[model samples]
Target: MVADVNVFVGQQRFLRLIDEETWATVPAVDPVWVDVPVTDYTVRNRPKRRNGQARTGSYQRRYGANPSGHPSGNLVTPLYGFVNEDLEISLAQLMMEWGFADHEVKFPRSKTAEWQYVGHDNDQRHLGLRVNTATLAGSEAGIVLTLELIGQSSVSFTGAASPPADRNKLVEFLFEDSTFTLGGTPLRVSQFQWSVQRNLDVIYHNSHNPISMPKTQFSETFSITPMKSNKTYDDLRDAFGMPELAGQLVLKGLHNGTGDTGNFTVLTIDFDRLSLIDSDESGGTGAIMNPLTFDVLKPDTADNGSAMTWTEAA
Candidate 1:
């Protein structure tokens, strides 16, 4: 029986401004901006096994006989050992789609001068007010942010052939489309990490003497950082053919690599933090955005067979 797998997002705290009246009326104010900490996400995988069946009285008597004694009932033995593949974590962005409104209001001027109007009281006040409000309704979507490798130790088995040729393929299968349930939603993997163990110990045992069998075990670890993908209110508007604006919508991802786990490693190839900074110089703000950390799993698809392209869900 395998234990329950556990995954968690580290704690995240940020200040959110709100209208006093609105705060009093609404249950909670939706966060306008979020800063995901560097220590907030974790993935844990474990394996389990059940006890072997008990021997019958006749079988026990037969197998328990001394070596000098004659054999009794047929001897019974346990069958099947356990085998587990690698574990992985992938991250992607999800589109939030709810709670949006746009409205306009006007204040008519009175001809009577019972009370003088305030300053800027031109002949006719023409205010072009556009009041738009929306909630951070969609799900979080983006490429796999990071991969935390655990239990990389290897154990040698005698029955199977050494050095399976499909080791890399096996790792890829475990990571691809690995989905986790978070906040009642499904999260997908965007990237993966591969840690290879160089040396492994192999043990052998003779049928006559099980205690004399030799055994060896090795350990290794790997990790990957997923990409970040959050669309701001402006991005949504533009996508829907609305006018462009100046404000930005920020999305953040938090991960924790310190818990008994090993240190997190970065494996980016082409775009580094510097390249992201350079993108800010252009008219695009998306370029300024990048994952807190990440690892290169394989060649990027968009590289025209040269590089890998990773992005959070949208």
Candidate 2:
């Protein structure tokens, strides 16, 4: 038996991050793209099915007699990738998606109403999914980024149309400039993580797609470490009513040159103010650091703000 020529191999399928200007319509040319070293990703369009069962004479369930109607459900996708010393170019998209105050995309996502631009004007078919949540974490083992997009049913079945021309390989964490600070003081920790999530409410209007998907609210969480020292217990023995502090995390790569931009990656996040939400002592085979979690909030000291500075240099 001959194999099908169109059968896809695992390695043949790749992912490219498309910076959509309007809804999910992928541009035909000059599309702003991000090269990602994605470990895994999936595109799912789930249909909410309806069953028509009738008992004319007896009771028997059959799998037929369905209406030729459209069913709508959530169209979702989750993209996962590994972060390295030589991080990929996905930083730009991630920064904008995370909605940094000054860097957020302000253009009309819905050219007309809330969801009118579901590739409708362009004659292309796509769902109105938007990225609502994302997470970035790093530890001794590795670094990872997880992004989730969710919205109403799609107008068409589609995935990444084409793979990026360059597939960057993962560079092990090495020769890097990384630091974590709280209240302008360094903290010794084992691991760290941060997440940004938008509270989206989708409005459906008896169709396969939504009329609007608006973000009602949003939140940001930061975990600077599993502190090796019992700074909490050592000082006060109390957890609640602790003082708030400003924090920062800087992750940078080796210096290739004075003004070079492509050889090293840079990420600097400044939290205007942070309050400790949770802290737990831990024991492990690795560093026995205290795992700490914080709720990132807007600054209260003179009304400062949070900011994220980034550079993509893979």
Best by TM-score: 2
Error of 1 at 257 (Å): 24
Scanning candidate 1 in windows of ten residues, the lowest lDDT window is 94-103
Candidate 1 structure quality by residue, lDDT tens digits, 1-314: 99978533222111111111221121244422111112222211122222334676553332222121110111111100111122122111111110111011111110100111122121111111111111111122322222221221112222211222322211111232233322233434343222212121111133221121111211222222233345332243345432211111122222123112232211111211110101011225553332221121222342211111222221
Candidates' RMSD to native: 31.2, 7.3
Superposed by TM-score, candidate 2 places the C-alpha of residue 73 at a distance from the truth, in angstroms, of 13
Per-residue lDDT for 213 in model 2?
Answer: 71
| Clashes in predicted model 2 | 2
**What digit string (tens of lDDT, one per residue) describes model 2 on residues 1-314?**
99878543444444334445566456677755444444554434444455557676757665553222222222122222223224343333343343333223322132110112122331223244465666766766556556565644434333334443333433433312467888888875567887766656666567555556777655778886545655663343264576567888876543333213565556677887677776667666855767667777865464434576766455
Pick by lDDT: which candidate is best? 2
Off by over 4 Å in 2: 1-7, 27-30, 33-35, 52-127, 151-165, 168-177, 233-239, 253-262, 284-287, 300-305, 311-314
**Cα lDDT of all candidates, in order?**
0.20, 0.51
lDDT of 2 at 297: 80
| Backbone Cα, N, C clashes tallied per candidate | 46, 2
